[model samples]
Target chain A: MMGLRLILEQVSHAYRDLSVLDGITLTAAPGEVLVLVGPSGCGKSTLLGIMGGMLAATGGTVSVTGEVAADCLNPLTYVFQDFALLPWRSVAGNIDLVLRARLPKAERQARIAEVLALTNLTEFAGAWPRQLSGGMRQRVGIARALAVRPACLLMDEPLSALDAQTRDLLLDEFAAIIARAGTTTVYVTHNLKEAVRLGHQIVVLSRRPGRIRATVRIDRALTDRTARDPDLLVIGEELWRMIRDDAAAAERERVDAPA
Target chain B: MPRLEGPVHFRAAGFAPKDRAWASAATLLGLLAMWQASASFGLIKSLFLPPPVAIATALWHLTVSGELWKHLSASLMRLFVGWTLGTVFGVGMGLAVGLWSALRSPGMAIVAALFPIPKIALVPLFIIWFGIGEGSKIATLAFGVFFPTVIATAGGVDNVARGLIRMGQSFGLSTGAIVRGIILPGALPAILSGFRVTTSIAIVLLVAAEMIGAERGIGAFVLSAGNLYDTDNLLAGIVVLSVLGLIVAWIIGRLERALLSWR
Candidate 1:
């Protein structure tokens, strides 16, 4: 199968009269990691939701692998920030949910086994979400998305819920895992450091109605570095400045608006 | 046994065995003593309320003569049949109405209107339609149980978290799979409680129906004893009914615990 490419052309989305995304255009090639960063309610997540086919655009086209309609991507999976694992299901059951449609019993078992090992979750297969720590649960979410073997993966602030150390550790693992899988990914977060660390191509958005403000390309070899690199810091600071200005402006707008 | 140490052991320890056993025994004795005192002191007339010992003696006599078994078996059969039918139809309809908007609006509106009409009020109609036999009795009991089960199950299914449904859809699950896998399990706790409520209603309706028109069963036995002023027999029959209801409820509670062990 051909690896996935996402192409969004002048895509606009609105909640009734309140427009969120306006005339936004972007693309992510096969095996590319596109990071979307903006202030809260700046339509970064709305754009991500549109890409994942969870929401439809009010205007323009979102083509996944040349499929014009979002629904055509039948197995487009997501890794949500909350790590929305069903509390009632065991770790293995959650992983199996994605593969239940296409794969037979044996193939499903095999795929689950492979992804469980990949995410280093083999020991906790039978454990419920409540029993596991937050980081471990997020790993289960990652394993669930990978188990689908999808053409593309969309993450909506997956690591934002974690503590600083856990977030950093998982970020490293996330970079390594996605690199090995080579699946096209669009990760949404407001954290500039995260955007700089994992994003091969970062798309910064203006405040609501959000539009792409800048797209920066990072060196792929940066993933090999153990420490926080100076290059990443420079890029993070630059992106932070852009995001801070927009966030302040958005806050001002919210305060000034009539209730 | 070696003495355990630390807060870990404290946490690991189950309920104190001595305290729990003693507490349970004391509770049972207290209830029995209260019943005996009430009946003996005539706070509750012995004709209306037999003491625990007198009820036990009456039970023993009835069991030895095999009379209690005959009445108990008949009542149990009616309860099982009516409850099973009511629960199955109620859950099925509830799931249908909860999942589908078209069905929910009209179907639930009708159920809500009719549910509170007093199922026993339909006894004369049921007798005319199904005749004054087991059919009429079972129908009354089943109808009584059905309404609550349907309402509860529908509410339960409706209350399932939307996040879980969205998650299931995103994974590309078919509608059937989503219902079977996510919706059903999500609603299991509420559905089980609905079943419990229906079970109680079925027992209540069964007794009412049996008392009105039936040759056998606990309620009929109670009615017959009342006419002869066989107060011991009447009180004994009521005791047996209470025990049967408790057993049924206990069994349902166990089933609920087993089924929802994952939760």
Candidate 2:
């Protein structure tokens, strides 16, 4: 499955008196991993939501430039921060849910099996979500998104919930999964190491009333780097230096503001 | 004498039932023994408190003559018809109120106003409306069961996590698909719990409705037996009601296990 090109042109969004995003223009090319990184109050998530059509920008155009393939199961899908899996559904059941409406019975079964294998959730196919570890549950979440053969996948801090060790382990697994799926993705996170490691193109946003700060391009192939790859770790540091001022300002604002 | 002490004395799995049947039987037998002693010793008047044996004897006689079946069949029939009607309509109205924005406010307002008023008191009004027959008796039970079911169903739907619904939308699931796949199963645990409460309410209202005017129900038999001073039959009828409640609870327990196995 190929990806869809998502374009945002001079987009602005506001919630009453508060402006969240402003004059932002970016393009996520087909099959590219565009990582959005910023401080806590930045509109990285809000932008991802707009791209996925979960939210609308208050001003300007957010458009998909490519036609969705007629055979594609879903044109776009969001992977939520909390995983958002139905607890009642087993891992296979969760993956099958997206395909149930459109696919033939045989195709649905095949797609569920394929995604389970791809996400390393084949062993957990019949296990309920409650029975899985946190990282495994998120694998089901990713598998569910991929079962659709979506053109674009939007993810919002999908690993923010795991402990440090799990997060470290799962980061490599996630990179491999996304690399194999080849779906255009807009990933949002505050973790700089994650940004530089997975991002083909990194778009940094400033704190509240978020606008583009810097756009960094990573030339390294995902297969060439492990989590401890020196070049990848250097880019992670570079990403931190770019956003450290905004993050520090946001922190001080939190300390100064009334509860 | 040696006493078991420390962790070895207690069962390793605290929740595991250990000789539960024996414990239950011993407690019941002890209670029956105490009751018989009181009656034989004349601590309480036999007229006021019939011994367990007298009650058991009356139950045996009623069962042999089919008198127990006569009262029991009528009450069960009413319960089946009334509870079925109430549950069907209650679930329908509940889904409508939960899913449709237009029905939500007005339907909730009507339910809130009607829910708290004693449904047993409405039996006299129902009798006047539907006559002193099975119609009035059934209406009382249906009315009593409907409100709570609606409240439970709507609350359950409300409590389904927002993220799951959003996930459904993200997957491009239709509204009907989302309701059937996500919302209904998500709400089942709460709705089944509501059934436990509604079944109890249904039984109580059934008894109250039967007491007022019904001729062939346990409630009516107990009231008439009291009037005739047949304490044995009266106690026998009360025991039947207790067993009916226990059966209803057991059915709900089985249903919860079957439907909510994931929980």
Candidate 3:
């Protein structure tokens, strides 16, 4: 079966007088991991929010699986930065919530078991969110998203809240999990290294009034080598340069604009 | 001077389980002893401040005559009916006001204005409307209990974490499921506290309402004893009321703990 795809045309959104996203357009093929990277206030999260149906775009159209507002296409799900695990629910309960409405009891239980195993969270099924570390909590977020069996997953800075060591470890686990599921994911982050490590293609957005700056395909290099591949480092450096330049220009614009 | 320490006493001197129990028992005995001493010495007239022994003897006499049971059963019936009805209505209205801005905005204004007026102030009006019978007494107690329960429930619902709601939405739960699964459970602890507070209020109002115009109930028996200057009976009635309040409060506390064990 073909994976889901997303297409956005002339998408613009504004918050009262301040424009956040200006005429943004992009497309992601089925099974592709599109990493949206940019500086702070670059409207990356806002754009992701719009895609996830959490925010309405002021202008333009968004279509998923070749259908705009299709009822059959499940609404996009999110993996938030804060992990956002319901404090009252245990690890398995959090994952079960997404599947409860869509799956039968036996199927839901089977799905929960599969996801918990996939996320290395089988031992944590009964643990509360507070008992889990930051990395583990984010894994629960991922597990919840996976349990829904959605067409697309929109992750906004999912690992930004973790420490460097935890982030590195989870990144490896995430790549393995995503490879198995083959789900189309739009992962948003400001970290260049994360984009290079996880993205099949990187879509760099310029700072506020964000516009798509470039789309760099890195699937070939990432697939052909080990975790410490030199080609991966080269591409990461390239993406960093592009982001740093845009970040500088965005800062200048902020200083020049009237407060 | 030689050290007075035994075994160096290295463990912390803070209240432990054994120490706490001993302290509580000692304080209770001291209070009882003081009451007995005052009555024996006639420091405060025995009529107004009966000794613990005298109160106990009075209780025994009333128990043998079946007088205590009759008034107690009447008062308890009023408390049960009034508190149950009050709790059900209060929680329902509180949840409605909390979940909907349309309901909350106007409803809160009315609740805020009326919650402060002494519910007892309405007792006279209730007596005229419902007559000086069980109807008025039950109405007064119910009204007294309702305000605190509703206010507590509303505040509890309002305080539920917004992040939890968002978390439920992200799971694609419907609006009703989100409120039922997340909001209700999250607000239960606060709501339980409100119940505990209202239980005591219900007891107080029940006795007050009974005293005003009732022929039965502990409050009425105390009033009758006052007319006859049967100080022992009056003291016994007051003691019975205090015990009733303590028992009800304890039951509510147990219920709160059981319901909110997750918290």
Candidate 4:
């Protein structure tokens, strides 16, 4: 299946007087992962929202091109940072939530089973989200997103809520899933290691009114990258160096500001 | 090797008070026994307290003569019809107020204005409007329950996570589907607990409405018995009301368990 390509043409946004995103132009190519990395308050999430059409840009336009599969229920789906699984729904029930509206009962069950199995959650289909650990809950989130066979997946810091060990484990699993599905994905996070490990194209944004400060391209396949690779580790450090001053400035500003 | 000394003073122990069913039963039984002993020893006159035994005897005679059933069925019917009407309308209005921005301010303003007025004080006014019969009685209970139910339901809707609703929309679920699948279930815990409050309010208004007008309800029976200086039957009616409250609370508890087992 050919994934849809999302093109942002000089998109910008502001919350009333405060401009959050400024002249952000980017493209998430078909069947590639475009990772947006930035410091806090840098509108990476806002950009993702604009790309997914969940939020309209106050300026410029976001256009979608290319074909999506006929069975795709949602062409642009989100994997939320908080892992927004309904506490009342079982793991399978949560995945079924998205599919039940479009698919027949038999097809819905099969799709749920496929995604659950893809996320290594086959044994947890009956478990409530509260009963699962943070990592497992996120697995349900990913499974739910995949159940729709989304043409373009928009993930917003999906691993930030998990612990270091679980994040590492799920990061590897995410790389594998993205590789296998080959769906155009726009991932937003502050973690350079994740950007290096999963991104085909990494775009770094400036602080506050987030602009595209730098764009780094990595041509290596997602599943082939590793945590300890020298070249990728250097890329991670380089990305950090690009954002270090903004990160430190944003941090101290946050400390001084009233909550 | 130095070890952690003296069990670290066991500082984390206390403050976790647990409910003991046996202790609860024992306390009630002990209180009743003391009251019975006081009555038997003539420490208190039966004219005032009527003791546990006298109350039970009166209850037995009332049940045998089917007078308790008459009063009970009447009160139960009023409670059922009035509370049901109030709840159905209350939930509908609450959802509209909570979901729609246009309705939120005006609905809340109206609710805030009406909710504070004492429902019992409105009984005579209701009697003039709905007439001096079951009409007035049910109206009193329904009016009493409606405000609190609306408040609880709207609060429940407010507490449903915005993230969940956004997730539903992102997945392209229809508006009706989102309300049914996410908003309704998310708000249910608050709504069910609200039932606990509204049910008790219904009972209180039921008693007040009956006392002011009706001839057959437990409240009316208790009021007449008190006027006649019959302490035994008066206490019997009080026990029946208390038991009814306990039963309703128990049913609500069972419902919470069944519906919210996920929590």
The DockQ values of the predictions, listed in order, are 0.45, 0.69, 0.37, 0.88
lDDT tens digits, residues A129-201, model 2? 8999999888888888888878888989999988888888888988888887777888999898888778999
**Best TM-score among the predictions, by candidate number:** 4
The deviation in Å at residue B49 for candidate 2 is 1.6
Q: What lDDT does model 3 reach? A: 0.84
User: Can you tell me which runs of candidate 4 are displaced by over 4 Å?
Assistant: B1-8
Residue A171 in model 2: shift from native, Å? 1.9
TM per prediction: 0.90, 0.93, 0.87, 0.97
Candidate 3 wrongly placed segments (more than 4 Å): A66-75, A221-227, A245-259, B1-22, B226-231
Model 4 deviation from the true structure expressed as Cα RMSD, one decimal place: 2.1
Q: In model 1, where do residues sit more than 4 Å from their true spots?
A: A66-74, A225-227, A252-259, B1-28, B37-45
TM-score of 2: 0.93
Candidate achieving higher DockQ, 1 or 4: 4
Ranking by DockQ: 4, 2, 1, 3
Error of 4 at A54 (Å): 2.2
Lowest-scoring 10 consecutive residues by lDDT in candidate 1 chain B?
B8-17
lDDT string for model 4 (B111-212, tens) is 999999999999999999999989999999989888888998999999999999999999999999999999999999999999999999999999889999
DockQ of the two-chain complex in candidate 2: 0.69
* Docking quality band of candidate 1, CAPRI definitions: acceptable
Judged by lDDT against the true structure, how good is candidate 1? 0.85
* lDDT digits (tens) for residues A12-84 of candidate 4: 9999998999998889899989999988998999998888878989998999999899889899999999999
Instruction: Indicate whether candidate 2 or candidate 3 has the larger lDDT.
Output: 2
Clashing residue pairs in candidate 4 are none
lDDT of 2 at A189: 90
